[model samples]
Target: MPSLTHMALVELEKAGILKFVISQNVNGLHLRSIYQGRLAELHGHSFMETCPSCGIEYFCDFEVETIGLKETSRRCSDEKCGARLRDTVFDWEDALPPKEMDPAEKHCKQADIVLCLGTRFQA
Candidate 1:
């Protein structure tokens, strides 16, 4: 269900025009579009969960039932560390995660052109 804009981004990445993507979208559409290059999901992806202990991420096929970094019904898959898995999405008051933000900042500093779509700058 990738949109034409998403497909175009993928092609741009393939053609080496687009380097990295910094997305505020929680729907996980960029990954679905097959853009396998660098990405930083600032708000968090609804289909993703992460282990608080091991920092391993699990990308689910369906939307997670919880947000606000709440614990899901599953545990981490790593045999040595089966910590509780928490949804990646954030609530209104939650601060943006540094794991996603740091790389995004780094990319933004390095990029010559930053193309933003469907979002507004809040100052």
Candidate 2:
């Protein structure tokens, strides 16, 4: 279940107070909260799997079985594309996916105020 904070973010987005959300969280709570606004999951989402061939993303009800972009048991829904789906979560050695990174960078640059929540900064 999504936390109260996640719910609040959704409300804020609905009111247009929150333009975009850049999250490092892989738990997919933001998505589960039904936030239909622009979101960039920089570290990938636990419940999301993507097709390599068709570039289609599937958001699952359950947490994906694997991380590090490994293939999952499911295949793409498109009749023409039956490629295996891969988990979106990143391993330690994995590079940041450009699909999420590019928009995150753009949003950061364009924003006047950036509110970061629940993040730990190490010195």
Candidate 3:
């Protein structure tokens, strides 16, 4: 999402209609441009890439070109491994992060209204 979507989410949160937004995106647009500590970005934020080995999430303040296209995907900033972090959001094989799931569950359990937008479910 972009700045507009981020603001809408923030407003929804303030209205208490939404506890958090679990995005299947790694853009980090919300985490960087919008309010922090209020979102549960499931796919991980782009501002920092975590090392699967060391579990170290490094913050890179350097400016990366926001090309707004597929070319935006690049290798991690760490020169050591230079591993290209996956930006396709949460992989099909990957499971949900505990930190993200907790809040989602809490919201679902307590929310008087469950709004499923544009979801396609199979019976």
Candidate 4:
């Protein structure tokens, strides 16, 4: 599912050169990529929603409309607990999602090499 460049990264990981990927992109491209399992979405995903009551992630094919961690129009599929599903897309006002942040922080500390895509990320 990865593009040529992303597949190149997958190759690195396959070779044990790339340990982890920390991404702030909401495009959901990474999720569709072959390296999806090895990456994290730091800013939440435009096509994902999470159940607050039960920690389950729903990855949808369609792009979620709302930002700022607002509740989406859908409900959790779990019948016993039909909780409102919150869109994972985050805004500047919200804090970084912990599910993504914790691993990113851990990898940043452990990795000997860090690649900055563009903007400088201050720890």
Task: Please report, in order, the local distance difference test score of every candidate based on alpha carbons.
Answer: 0.89, 0.88, 0.57, 0.81
| Candidate scoring better on lDDT of 1 and 2 | 1
lDDT of 4 by residue, 1-123 (tens): 456866776678778898888888787776665356568788888988989888689988888878888888999989888999998888987888787888888888998998786457776
Error of 2 at 97 (Å): 1.2
lDDT per residue (tens digit) for residues 1-123 in model 3: 366766776678778676655565666766754466656666555556454433445555643333221223456566676654432245546787787878777766776876554336332
Q: Which residue pairs in candidate 1 have backbone atoms (N, alpha carbon, C) closer than 3 angstroms, thus clashing?
A: none
| TM-score, per-candidate, Cα-based | 0.88, 0.88, 0.55, 0.85
Candidate 2 ranges beyond 4 A from true positions: 34-37
Considering lDDT, where higher is better, how would the candidates rank from best to worst? 1, 2, 4, 3
Q: Count steric clashes of candidate 1.
A: 0
Please give the lDDT score for candidate 3: 0.57
Positional deviation of residue 51's Cα in model 2 after best superposition, in angstroms: 1.2
Better candidate by TM-score, 2 or 3: 2
Worst 10 residues of 3 by lDDT: 63-72
In Å, residue 49's CA in model 2 sits off its true spot by 1.2
Put down candidate 2 lDDT per residue, 85-114, tens digits, no spaces: 999999989998898889889998999898
